[model samples]
Target chain A: MLARPAAEKGLNNYMNDMFAFDETDRKIVEQLRRNGRATNQQIAESLNLIASTVSTRIRRMEEAGMLRVVAVSDFAVHGYHILIHLAVQVSGRPALEVAEDLAVFPEVFAAHLVTGSYEISLLLTLRDIDELPPLITGTFAKVPGIKSMTPAVGLDIVRYALDTGPVDSRSAA
Target chain B: MSRPELDDLDRQLIGILAQDARVSNRKIASDLGVNEGTVRGRIKRLQQEKLIAFTALTGMKLEKAANIAFMAIQADTAHVRRIARDIADIPLVKAVMIMLGPFNVMATCLYHDLDDLHRLASGRILEVEGVTHVETSLVVKTVKISNRVVRITDADTLSQG
Candidate 1:
């Protein structure tokens, strides 16, 4: 039907808007990545642009929900020496609702509604290994809709960055 | 321990930065009723201790990610670390963690489609020397992605995100 092409065009437009940054914008983002605390004036000096322009571009990116400048706390900072990846299979309720419930826990850093073998996935930070039992049996057990879970404790953080990185293929082989 | 290693002032400063990393150092110093030197010193000490960092988080483009998978792999223990590092080099593999549970190695990846995911798993991951097995689960929706889901003890600050 004609409706399909129209819907496709709308989706394409939405995608285009999200990644509409030009060469200057990309360079600005690269500069931020190199040093997040760099001031707008510093960035403008390096990029050879106006300070206000750099500020405007960063603000625009933040407003569009595409980027943010935030403080990143190390796991050890809060006594969370253990990082856990849990695959959860949901039952008796919608996965999204359960995921939202899981997200409320301060220990959960990232919670996603997923498919294939599991219905949900969680990345949690824990202070100690001893806290695992109490968390699994006491706290998580009380939460409804969780059927089963398989947890993997991180032995080493090979790589972990919240940023998705640059849009270009430079990072690739 | 029941409490985190922070005093009230540290908690407040951290909370403010958690909300906005780029808040002027002067502003933070003024709000915290401390001098600019004190604020700068605290941040420097914290970074030296590897407690916190300031950075920009670029969100994954909605359209670019047609499939996101958490791939769990079993690798020989001796080479787990090396294998994990190798996997991290792969562009699509965003994160790699050497674990000590049901799976020995885990990777988070963003790909264009199921076929792309398949190619990475089969063509690339399977080719690794130490890898024994691989399992993947595709993400259907992102419930929450936040850098500030920290529980700052003693201050009673638990982020809603």
Candidate 2:
């Protein structure tokens, strides 16, 4: 149900025109979104399709870089005492470089370049609030082309989803 | 919530659906090289066994609802369970966990404003019988949130084993 026109014509054309997914492929993607480690046999059975077909489609999708299945944990239960989101505004270096560097930090779970006042937003986890000052002052602020940062600690997470939404299988039809 | 002993095939099926829940049985059957009927039957059994359950994700669109805070609570041993239950009943609380270390209970709460948050932290939370200390931090924004458990690629790779 979530649809956005690709920012570039080449990638968009390649995905939409060159690589059009069939209903079965979309369904396969859906199944994987629900459980990344789903076996091809299991996926095929769920969709009432041949297992070989499911396997082939999954292989194709993986090569395309459209999806990846990985493990994730809730930091709150894992002894992560301090959770915070940093809204960073950059002035000099390429935003992507800053984002890539931030992503490498073990405490950083995720980072993104977004529109509006901030150029990048980072999600971080730590063992205690005391650990935060050193992380920001020593690492984040030291990144070249640095500008300003607004840190918002996460008090609670109400809801979140990994997949944007169900694949529009109807599009294939 | 019945924990059924899943076979390899069952694990495969669960993995696929865990990533994409809307996949059709026909498509899934094709991919796994199994009969559609078998896929259907297995899914039915999985659901019946209570190994799998489904819930839609909601409230991603941010609203100007209230200020949110995270609080770590330490309580006397005898009063821990009772206090946990009481905090869970508070409607504004979104998530709570019983943790180890200095803080025994960790919780997330939402309020209409700072005053509401202050009232709960000072009045209700502090008033609890066995509470020794409370550390609170306010959340400004959320970058990512997810409940999906990561897939264990290799059992042999597990350190515990």
TM-score of every model versus the real structure: 0.79, 0.44
Q: Which stretches of candidate 1 lie over 4 Å from their true place?
A: A1-19, A164-173, B1-7, B62-67, B148-161
Clash number by candidate, in order: 0, 47
Per-residue lDDT for A56-151 in model 1, tens only? 778767765666666666555567678888989999999999999888887786888776788998998878788788888988888999999988
Model number 2 iRMSD:
12.1
lDDT of each: 0.71, 0.56
DockQ of candidate 1?
0.38
Candidate 2's error at B135, in angstroms?
A: 29
Predicted candidate 2 versus true structure: per-residue lDDT over A71-136, tens digit per residue: 222232235556666667888788778777777777786565665566776667787788888888
Model 2 lDDT per residue over B8-125, tens place: 7777776676555557779889999999998889877765543443322212111123455667678786767777656755556555545554467766566667778788888788
